[model samples]
Target chain A: MAGSNPGCGTTRTFKYQVRDQFGQVMLVYNMQLWDSIVTTSTNTCNLGGYNTTCAITNTGPCNVGTFADGTFNENLGICAPAGHLVSGGCITGCTTTADQTWNINGISLSGDVKNLSYQCDRSW
Target chain B: MYTLLLATLLLQPIWALPPPPSEQGLQVKLRANLENYTVAAETFPQALTKVAAQFEIPMGIEWIRTSATQREIRRSWRHTTVYGVVESLVKSQSGYDFAIANGVIHVFPKGALMDRSSFLNHRINKFEAKNEFAGVLSYRLRELLKRTISPPLPSSPALGTAGSIATGAGDRRITFRLVNASVRQILDKLSLATDFRIWIVTYPEDRTLTETGFRRVASLYTSSSVADNEQPVWAFLRWGDALPK
Candidate 1:
């Protein structure tokens, strides 16, 4: 996803991995950064053999899928297709973005990728 | 007479004994001089982050929801100890204090250290990692918490753990062994073991879990702005990246 600067302060786009309880990346989401204000783009994708789009608001939970057997097939990169469906838990994680500049008082110092990365969570 | 002597020895005040090595080491680090540090104006967390980066000290900050901590502060010190700098910073803001534990400088509210309900107070039976990325370690801790604590207590909220580390080659990793340690102690160990010596855990102003019943997950970052948020976030900092250019 692309982020627009709009010539205000600074804007950056970040790639976030939405992982399950086992640290498996279930889906990916892109975020637009405006200074400290962050907004998530609605992403629709095929995950775990289920076609679904997670409704992610600003720093909100991205309910990816509720698999029957509580497992996603690693080989197929989707949920196993042969189990009964069950209620799945919400996927939540930290939504804080990394800033490109560190402002101490009035001074601005450049920042790097090591500053911050996007994160999300999953439960088995 | 020997039994009486033994009884008297056992009755000696705890203060008479020397502090543990970790506490002593922390005390030394706190006494180290901070030369030529100045900030025109910044929030409490901002100033603390700057000082930790400049001094290359392992520091962790846990913030509570309060307006007193949100106010801006200003200070200029030509030469002063880290302890003095931290003391002044804590004094600049109300409803906060500092402590040295597991050889890390931790700043939090006065009673947070003893708050049993805090996630920091949760105990881990065993944690051993070798050359693990700091973010991965954080993920492991979250998994451990879910495995050990959540299933038995169905009413407890599931902790949403997230972390981001520097990708690509040359990323920093850590190795350590901890047995029967609290979440706070593990964080302190991470601070001392990696270049990401600075850690911060923030809380939402509402101080309530979502309707889904999950406590605000702590997000681990390599480096980031000290900006406060309405959501909970846990972040770490690399001293090298935070240095003044």
Candidate 2:
């Protein structure tokens, strides 16, 4: 009787630390009500046409739920379990998409040059 | 009487004045001309290190670990000073920049240099070290930052996960004292005082992370020539590719 009746699964929040190549902590994110069965897919293409040129598709289990911060996309599946680390792709170059001015240590630096953006690993 | 004194001072030979501060040595070295310099293909740090060694000048290089860093850098400079070569190399790269401070060449990312939230700008009340090994001193500085920062940096077991600190009778030692100095200044002082001249700090390039968070995972690189037991903290590799034991 005990084996026949399964109780409701417990819900818990999971925390993931995104680290860099040097094992430095880049950022931290939390996921709530993680559904192990959920999966997500993404399609990326180069400058060429999607069908005629280079195209890549990635499909993985959707481990990430809502991000505490609004900066990242909601459907990001990069965060994995404690032992299951994810590899974010390398930044292509020094060019950044952040357009803002910064006044650092009494010196004002303003330009389109801003924070470097990471190109996520589509290989996953 | 005052006019006479002023005239006498003006008449004194310029050589009587003290030589420029030691910090100007870096400028002099940078301006020294080179007939030719060439590199087939190497990382920016590798190219810069080769040049720095040729000039026998100390340098500190900081950057983000990216495909760009591993990208082959091939350049040849003819009839140029060290300054020209450095300027050209950094300008050719998108996110890199350099600053000469405290008699050390510091190559770093433009964003890390300009980001107001960088831990480099954190102020320390007092920092004093006597006859300290270069690697140990560097570790202490990081510890100081972790302990003193107001909001406090995130605690991680990885912080203790660095290459083994080299120790021996033959190890180089340094001594310095500073009051009210920024972490950047401390690093410059350390570079100037140690044989581990080539310092590199690598940052993560995640746009979603807060600027301050970059410091948490930044890796420090220094000269590999110290001793057989001594080695640089980490080699250039992708994140999570390998974990240190």
Candidate 3:
């Protein structure tokens, strides 16, 4: 399911576990700077699940939380506002290119493990 | 006869008592220096309103109004009417704050002191704008004393007098010349590098007769020492940057 595209009129579920170190979960819905949206939920848990039905309203270049509950199941479809191109890009930690980089507060992490080595990207 | 002598002895020197300052005394003293202040009054504008708004404590003349009643009229024709003016002064731990409580009318300081004084003195003295607004410096100093010392009301009471005239006619053209020439001259003296807007507010009504009861009329705004120009001018400038908000 790493690169699967879930079509319209369908719901997809991804099971995730949040580690104890970072107590917050953040899902980056889109990657465009001007049209970006990030949703944050909080709790300490190693296991959690989120099911998102994708349409023309919630397309994303997505990134999950850093630690516990950081895993996400992404359903992909054509979701773009007017004057925007529907697009998809993979993101992990805080890096745009590296799938395992964890960036927070403008500092980037180095280790592959969740919450270990991640970048701190606090620029808003 | 002994009782009468005793009463007289006990009543001695009441005549030597010092009298309190009278309202008539205040008015007489003020009028003697009336040549100094440019007295005018009208509905206050919003610039003054903003200054008054800053103060939780009121300062200067705030609420002013007039009323006529049947009972007052019955006593005397003048008694029927009254003009009530209220002023407030505030002392903040930071500094002094003053505001008038009037709903819309109040005293807000304009940054340009000398220019305001110049125009005001010209009004009071009825002079042809010799740039003598600085004359108000002495008058303002005098008012400081009045604010500190004078009693609130006068025994004689103030008799209000007002008149106005307008002109765009006749060979004299005195009104037009005075207004236009004075404004132009002042503007010319301002810093050339900077631009300024000028406005005139006349009392009673903007369209009132050329002669009117002016409590005061002044320039609404001004800046200091236009660029490099340094001339010893003082008036509104005396308050400096501590101008009322």
Task: Identify the leading candidate in terms of DockQ.
Answer: 1
Residue A73 in model 1: lDDT: 10
DockQ (C-alpha based) per candidate is: 0.02, 0.01, 0.00
Local distance difference test, candidate 3: 0.20
Per-residue CA lDDT of model 3 for A16-81, tens digit only, reads 322223533433221111011122332111111111111011221111112222322222122111
Ranking of predictions according to lDDT: 1, 2, 3
Q: Residue-wise lDDT of candidate 1 within B1-245, one digit each (tens)?
A: 00000011112111122222366776887899877767644456667877777665678888754466556767877788888988888766767888877778889877878876566777788888765544446545654554433332455432221222111111234667899998889877766665567777765445554333434443322122222121223555555333121
- In candidate 2, stretches whose alpha carbon ends up further than 4 angstroms from where it belongs are A1-124, B1-21, B148-165, B168-171, B207-214, B220-245
Badly placed stretches (over 4 Å) of model 3 are A1-124, B1-181, B187-207, B212-235, B238-245
In terms of lDDT, the poorest run of 10 residues in model 2 chain B is B1-10
- Summarize candidate 2's per-residue lDDT along A8-95 as a digit string, tens digits: 1111111222233354543333221111111112211111110000000111111212123211111111112122222332222111
Error in Å for residue A98 of model 3: 92
Query: For residue B162, what is the lDDT in candidate 2?
Result: 11
Question: What is the docking quality class of candidate 3?
Answer: incorrect
Candidate 1 CA-lDDT value: 0.45
**Alpha carbon lDDT at A98, candidate 3:** 14
In candidate 2 the C-alpha lDDT for residue B126 amounts to 90
- Distance from true position, residue B70, model 3, in Å? 35
RMSD of each: 19.1, 25.3, 34.3
